[model samples]
Target: MSNKDEAITIVSNFLEASMAPDPELAATYMAADVRITFTGGRAMASPQAITDFNSGRYAWVKKALGPFDWTEHEDHTVVYSNGTLYGEWPDGRPFAGNRYLDRFEVRNGRITRMDVWNDSAEWLLTPELNQES
Candidate 1:
């Protein structure tokens, strides 16, 4: 597989494991010292930290996988996955269609860096986003 294809596979596996509620498993797809930046600009030192933060945000959450857009560079492959989120709030309200964009930097088949951006924060700021349907 080309570098871009490999990066896409690696990221797909990582996201699947993460959405399986197994960040520990997801960590296997990452570099030992990977840097992760979550939505709201929180820098997480580890995958477990990201899981912990998500636990507090919603009772349970998972990524609804989407197509992976990959860019191969001279040094690394960058992959962006755009998707929606589905889960329940702490108050037991279900939420879906929370758009997310995740960017990953892969080198030698391991993700070295990940940056996450999602509409969750914007949803929080816009009360209409939480209305019961």
Candidate 2:
């Protein structure tokens, strides 16, 4: 497979592992010194840190993955995966379509860096908008 294909596969498998709520499995894709940045400018050093953070944010959460858009570069492959989230909130209400964007830097079949963005911060800023439907 090409670098682009490898990047996509690595990202796809990582997402699948994450949806399984298996941070250990997902971390396998990451580089030893992987850098992660979450929504709201929260920075972390590893994939496991992201999982730990999310556990405190929601009662239970899972990603509804969409598609992967890959960009091949000389140094690394950049993969952008866009998706929505669906799960029970801490208050016991279900929510979906919490749009998310994840950018991964893949090198030699491993993700060296990742950056995440989502709509949750906007919802947090607008407290009245988080109501149950």
Candidate 3:
């Protein structure tokens, strides 16, 4: 497989492990010095930190994964994963169609950086927008 394909697979596997809430497994796909930035510019040092943050913000969550778009650079591959998030919130409110976009930098078969953005904050600010009308 090409480096691009491998990067995609690595990212896909990591996402699966993450949704499984298996931080140890997820960590396997990331570099030891991985940099992760979530919504609100929260910096995370490791996969376990991500799980902890999620646990606080969501009762349970999973991604409705979309296509993986990538660009290969001289030393690393930049991959973008765009999709909607579906899950229950901390308040036990089930929500769907919360769009999310994640950017990852994969180098030498491991993800070195990740940035995440999502619409959950907007939904939270105006919960009536998430209510079934």
Task: State residue 119's C-alpha deviation in candidate 3, in Å.
Answer: 0.4
lDDT of each: 0.88, 0.85, 0.94
Candidate 2 Cα deviation (angstroms), residue 88:
1.4
Off by over 4 Å in 1: 130-133
* Model 3 whole-model lDDT (C-alpha atoms): 0.94
Per-residue lDDT of candidate 1, residues 68-107 (tens digit):
9988889999999998888888878788888899999998
| Per-residue lDDT value at 58 in model 3 | 91
Give the TM-scores of the predictions, in the order they appear.
0.94, 0.92, 0.96
Of candidates 3 and 2, the better by TM-score: 3
Greater TM-score among 1 and 3 belongs to: 3
| Cα error of candidate 1 at position 98, Å | 0.5
Candidate with top TM-score is 3
Q: Give the TM-score of candidate 1.
A: 0.94
Quick one: best lDDT, which candidate?
Answer: 3
Candidate 1 lDDT at 49 equals 89
